[model samples]
Target: MITYDPHKWLDHFFDIRGSLVKEISGRVLICVFWSAGVVYFDKNYHDVNISSLLHTLVGLALSMLLVFRTNASYDRYWEGRKLWGGIVNETRNLVRQATVHLSGERDLVVHLAQLNVDFAAACMYHLRGAKIAGMLESQHPPLTIATQMTFALQEARRRGAITDIILASMDQNVQLLIDYLGGCERIRKTPLPFAYVVHLRRALVVYCFSLPFALVDTYGWATVLDTLVISYVFFGIEEIGVEIEGPFGLDENDLPLEDICTTIRHNLFALVELEHSEPDKMPEGL
Candidate 1:
């Protein structure tokens, strides 16, 4: 996602990198030209007056629908972030426990830590509908990594490296990884209802096109400016909702999954290095 200082109002006002201006500029221009045409016809040809009161009622309803649409999309975006946050926390917990509890077995601890990093990377790729380089043969890379981790934990428990209780606790963390994966998949697969989106878009177009009729009577030639500003607002709102609804792609406004995965990898490797370098500080048992 694009990051900026929220306190910098002047910088943001002039910034267009992550803004919807490019996406909605064409629609806004169409509305402006349409308004200019309506003004020209009214001035030179005949009186073309539309009921301003009727347009006012329609505008109120459209505004409410737009608000709902934006809210729903934001909810999905926030939920995706929360689910990834859970993944980050659980991965750290599992690695920390492994580092302390299996400090003597440095090789085993390193293997487990690598698996956690792989699982996180796999999840990032899976959500974006892509595949990791070596794991392209695997249908579900995250699940495959999760299964490997489970088996490794089981082997550790069988060989007396860890007790049944410790194994169970670590296993729970692995299960939570799968749960987070499921949540991400659900959000990616399910979208807003088709009919609702279609109707909302249609209403936006109709409202924007009819706005000229409502404003030309009073604003005259300046109706072009008014329509341009109003249409830009409406179209910009809708474009933002569309861009953030999935929250997994590489859009400027989408979640930064690459950065998040890199963080997980760095954290896990750091924990492993700490365990190896300071084995004397680690406790004997869990």
Candidate 2:
């Protein structure tokens, strides 16, 4: 989503706009102040005696858990991408097949092609949690439209407009479209489980808050700086996982759902446009 020129290391470091800075800065500040308190408490009333070994063990355990959390989140993201990728490829195949087999039924083919495009947009809108008018399929507008398109194909087949082999091919693509919709819905509906999220958050918060106490005796006042950096890393990783888990929302890391549908719409129409735009090449004899 965020395109960049190849490997400008300095620019990446200084960049603030798209950085996780906004998300992590507040927590980083809290860590700094919390660390400062730990230092003051140690300087005034002796040290808290929190063991370095104890903190190291807890941090190690939490880090492993975070790794699992982030990995699961990224798995969902990639799954959503693959499902939508299937939508893109299968839609094009469907349109191309229609153009080949239903060439004589120009109007019908164009209408069906447009429906396919509509199905794509509706599918994305469904994923993004947007409400559709008339409440078709109760916010599952994509599925509703998909069914309509399939029925239309059935009618065409019954009318003897398309051959049996061609109908079978088109039906396969339609089934794929339905499967994609189901896959996206599965991701959207089932997020990281509640108990898992709760435990992870609680452990991370406890670990990060206790870190300064553990380090203050060793590093003294420098604990503030260290705490900020460490907090940024821990919180940033989790925040990134949260943002990308859905892969359908407005987050920059989320898939570009609208753009994908827009390109497909353009392509489907363009495929049809090519036929009308230029006259067929005259035969050599003609």
Error of 2 at 58 (Å): 1.5
Candidate 1: tens digits of C-alpha lDDT, residues 1-286 = 9888899899788888889788888889888888899999999999887879987998899889999999999999999999999999989999899898887778778888899989988898899998689988899999999999998888788778899999999999999999998999999999999999999999999999998888888888888998988899899999989999999898999999889989999999988887666556776782
Off by over 4 Å in 2: 133-139, 277-286
The TM-scores, one per candidate, come to: 0.95, 0.92
Candidate 2 per-residue lDDT, tens place, 1-286, comes to: 5667767878667877656789888877887888888889899998784888987888898889889989999999999999999999998998887777777778867987898898998887788878766665464678777777787677778878887777887989989999998999999999999999899888878888898888887888888888888889988888888878999887767888889999899999887766555456533553
Q: Using TM-score as the measure, which candidate wins? A: 1
lDDT of model number 1: 0.90
What is the Å distance of residue 196 in model 2 from its true position?
1.8
Q: Each candidate: what lDDT?
A: 0.90, 0.84
Residue 14, model 1, lDDT = 82
- RMSD of each candidate relative to the true structure: 2.8, 3.1
> lDDT (0-100) at residue 148 of candidate 2?
77
